[model samples]
Target chain A: MARLTKIKTRKKGGATEILVLVNHPMETGQRKNKKTKKKIPAHYIQKMVFKIDGKEVADANLGPAVSKNPLVGIRVAGVKKGASVKITWSDNKGESGKAQTTV
Target chain B: MNTIRRRTFLKGTVASGFAAVAATSGLLRPTEVMAAAWPKSAFKSKKLDKSIKNLFGSSKVTASKAIKIKAPIQAENGAVVPLTVSTTMSNVEAIGVFVEKNPSPLATSIDLTGATAFYSARIKMGKTSAIHVIVKSGGKLHVAKKTIKVTVGGCGG
Candidate 1:
């Protein structure tokens, strides 16, 4: 599972822009464990969903080919000042986490 | 044999030699040899919908063109490659990245609320793969993709 950090958002051209960083290894199952010499089962976050003011906005499909840590950026419109936006994600192992911000 | 028969045989031999030379020089129709390769089965997971909702707080997402993903055309090291995603929409919420050829597939997810529409980071690549970016804005989903060629294998191949 990945951990979210450095979440930030701002207004741009009548829309809101957001940036984020995540901490994760993003191991592909093709690699073998160093100690056991056994293949590590594929375990990566498969999907992510973004919501603004309780309205579903965007979603992404993930794969294991990605590097250790990743950063992402997004922009949304129609959000008023003080509105809240939420993000959630899940891995192949069913582990999930959530983060939120106020507009 | 007679003179006419001998002459005909010589002509046939010359024509065949010319054909062979042309084929070797690639002047003839070349064959496309497709490689025998398949995606690893372990990357396919059934929890696609669940993973999306878990990341975005909702299961609904629409594909859009507002997102732009930038990656290298070729990477010498599969262990690390620079990636950047930028968007131009308002009321943005989050961004996510994926590598299509990885065993599990999902690479990373990030939450964005009060920042710019640009994000940059480095990620590992086990092999050549497609990098995808998903952006959420104004209750809509935007997507983009780029192909990256990895020379080395990061998955211990």
Candidate 2:
């Protein structure tokens, strides 16, 4: 199985900042295997959602252009400490993962 | 007790059109409740102009001087080109990174909140192409582009 996403949340004043990192190959399907020299299929994260206490605050739409193991930083207002910050993503090949942390 | 009240208040705010203001502010929440699916056609476009049009609803983007793109002039590897886009402008609601030469031109689209003007990512380039950084702020669009030459191939088959 691939690596799970990493999530971290911190409280700043009345708002909370969430940071996320996803581990993925993000293959462009244009690369060739070193040994077999076969075209590797394209696989990359297509979408990501950031939910706070079950409320969506932000999200990102990605493409094959995104690098392997992407990192994103987000800030949401009016969120307090001890709030639930959950990050989830789905790739092009229908693979998905989720990670959660508290603020 | 507090969580239930907060949830109900949010539900009421959505019905009261406050979510519309939040959408414009780049903190959209109602869209998550109504539609959770990502924009498929926008990310699947092979053409640069069409992808821009599909995502931004317009392909007419003017080059601006306020936007800054921090990327290598010549990428060592097309598989992992580190990119950082920051803007000097205010009220920046969203930032999009587009690779003009890839099969899918739209690399990433990130909606921001609480006064953010920067976005960074690692993008794959199939070949040498122009990188367009589009910043949507104050209900308008500003763009900056730079051509990055790929040294070693990564995206081409």
lDDT accuracy of residue B2 in candidate 1: 91
lDDT of 2 at B126: 80
Best by lDDT: 2
lDDT tens digits, residue span B1-157, model 2: 9997567556544543552454345554422422444555567788988877666666777789999898999999987888878777888877788988888888898776542465667788888999999887786778999999998755755
- Stretches > 4 Å off in candidate 1: A1-6, A11-14, B1-69, B73-77, B84-123, B128-152
lDDT of 2 by residue, A5-88 (tens): 898766654556567888788877667888898987677787787787887665678877787888776667677667778888
The DockQ figures for the candidates are: 0.16, 0.27
Off by over 4 Å in 2: A8-18, A32-39, A75-83, B1-36, B113-115
- DockQ, candidate 1, vs. native dimer: 0.16
TM-score, candidate 2, first chain: 0.86
Q: On residues A45-94, what C-alpha lDDT tens digit does candidate 1 reach at each position?
A: 55556677787655544456555554555666667888877877665544
